[model samples]
Target: MIRRRYIDGRYGQVHLRENTPLGEPPLVCLHATAYSSRSFSALLAVLDGKRHVIALDTPGYGESDAPDGRIGIEAYAESIAEVCPDRFELFGYHTGVSIAAEIAIGHAARVDRLTFMGIPHFRALDFAAWRSKLAARHVLGERLDQFEERWRFFVSERAARLPLGRAFENFVDELKAWPHGWWAHDALFEHDLLARLEQVRQPTTVLNPPGHLAEPSRRAAAAMPDATVIELPEMPGPALDLYADTIASLLLAKQFVGGAVPA
Candidate 1:
């Protein structure tokens, strides 16, 4: 179920969804651009009974209000700080990983464990090329074959289970509109995480998504001096189950039920 809340310093009443809110020390989920936490529903089910999977519709997406352009990853991190959990585990997918990285690095004391899905950051690939693809100027015409090639990977497998016609249309509508300047704050991602690598202290599991994104991410994990890397394939089984096995192992390895968070 979802609840509307006003986290101080937040843009407005934040819309947060809790999956059976089992208890404190919840597993928190952060989603990518053009996605609400709802996107993770298919993955949340298999996370096991130990976690109270909670998803937030980051401001400017879904039911949440748009934060002012002045906001940065740190601001979103700060908004996340308001979550009154006895303890918390951070899980971020794709663009969400960028935020999780900032939070885990900046507010190390707040996070107990970290999980990053589709980590597009800390890669050898040049950001300039990535930015070019995201540029609206690159897709102003009808003959945009280049963009479609990549956009297909973004489709959900659950689309087949949905009514298809209307549900798919509504799914498109839920994506947060890309307003100018509300995107990737370079300064937020600018700091070299390598500098404070050891400071992460908490166990981190970087799980690449179930597709082509996994290869480069596997390379990224190999380079991380301290992370555990796991690749989940798109086939062989349901995507979420693979994620569950990876995370369960990480938690068991760390033996981190963590400690009590402040009230």
Candidate 2:
């Protein structure tokens, strides 16, 4: 069973969802922007007995305390590292990828390896446009119609393949972090991600699912010194929930071959 708890962190309290069946070094997970650790519930369930896993809600999201003001990706990485084990492999999805990369670069001794579901590599102009567009969507006191429009956009474009219930759960997570949902994106676009990826010397795996991020993820992987790309064209929309077993098997196999421990 997955258990939830909180630990003192840089911001105040950091909420964590953990499943620890064995005593091996844990695999720490970080979720995408606006979403919480709950996004990894399905993934954690599949890896329950096979490997110990802990998924954290990035500061300012889920039950974790919000920061005093907007911070950069490095701050996000530091806050997350403050609550992580001294040594462990890391897995990140979307926005979490940026934070994970920063951690691997800044806290090299702590992170053993890295796994990213999507690594966004956008041009300066493109990123700026995207930041502006997303910021507009997240207006604090937007009209109900605007909110509904955003909801419909998420369901149709982002969560099209997700089951109704699962999609709704994700949407609710977005709502819960509505006020600061754009903060991570702001930090992400401002960071020198490609340079940081190049600095990450840890063994890395990039899982590329079919979507807008697929090409960018491939390009980002090319810059990393030690990285492998696993294309998941067949798995679309929320691979954590849809392809949990596959992902779990791959992660276990990697750790076993690396002499970490047998899953």
Candidate 3:
């Protein structure tokens, strides 16, 4: 069962959902922007007894307290790291990838392995476009209809499998975290991912699922000193929900028995 808990950390109270098995090195998961640790619901369900799996809500992005100022990726990394075990593995997606990479680089001894999906590779020019979109999404008119409109548009794009009620709840989760959502995007824009990846010493796995983020994962795999790239040619959104088992297999094979070339 996934249990929700709070940790008083440097920033403030950090909320996390976890399924911990006794004596195993924990698998700490970080989520994408606009989403919380709830993004790993499916994965956690499947991984419940397999290992110790902990999914953290990035500060200001879930039930966690917001930082005093707009912080960079390093601060985000520090927040998550403060709540983790002395030795653990990492799973990160999109914005989470930036934070995870920073942690693995700076605290190499604490992380046994690193896994990333939807690794972002953005150039300086992309920030303008991102800022425009962020501005549009940051609609806080204090009108219920406006929130509903935003919720519908978001659900139409990603949560088709979810029922309307559950989807709306998830959308509200996004809305409640809106103030900090754009902060993650800005941090990603400023992050030097290549420089960070070069410093990662743990064994790494990059999931190359077809999407805007796939090519970046490919680039990231090449940059890592010891890394394995898994080619998953499915649409990223649905594939992420359905392929938790596939990822579990990789983690088990690599970290438990023996690592091998992905078949």
Most accurate candidate by TM-score: 2
The residue-by-residue lDDT of candidate 1 on 119-180, one tens digit each, is 66444466666655543332234554643433353444443444344345434533344332
Top candidate (lDDT): 2
Give candidate 2's whole-model lDDT.
0.85
lDDT of each: 0.58, 0.85, 0.79
Worst 10 residues of 2 by lDDT: 134-143
Which candidate do you rate higher for TM-score, 1 or 3? 3
**Whole-model lDDT, candidate 1?**
0.58
- Arranged by TM-score, best first: 2, 3, 1
Off by over 4 Å in 2: 156-161, 258-263
Sort by lDDT, best first: what order?
Answer: 2, 3, 1
Kindly indicate the candidate among 1 and 3 with the higher lDDT. 3
Write one digit per residue (lDDT tens) for candidate 3, span 58-146: 99888888888688999999888988999999998989999999999878899999888887775423646765664343646666775
Model 2, position 105: C-alpha lDDT score: 87
Clashing pairs in 1: 86-261
Off by over 4 Å in 1: 1-9, 47-49, 84-86, 135-175, 178-182, 185-199, 210-212, 223-225, 234-263
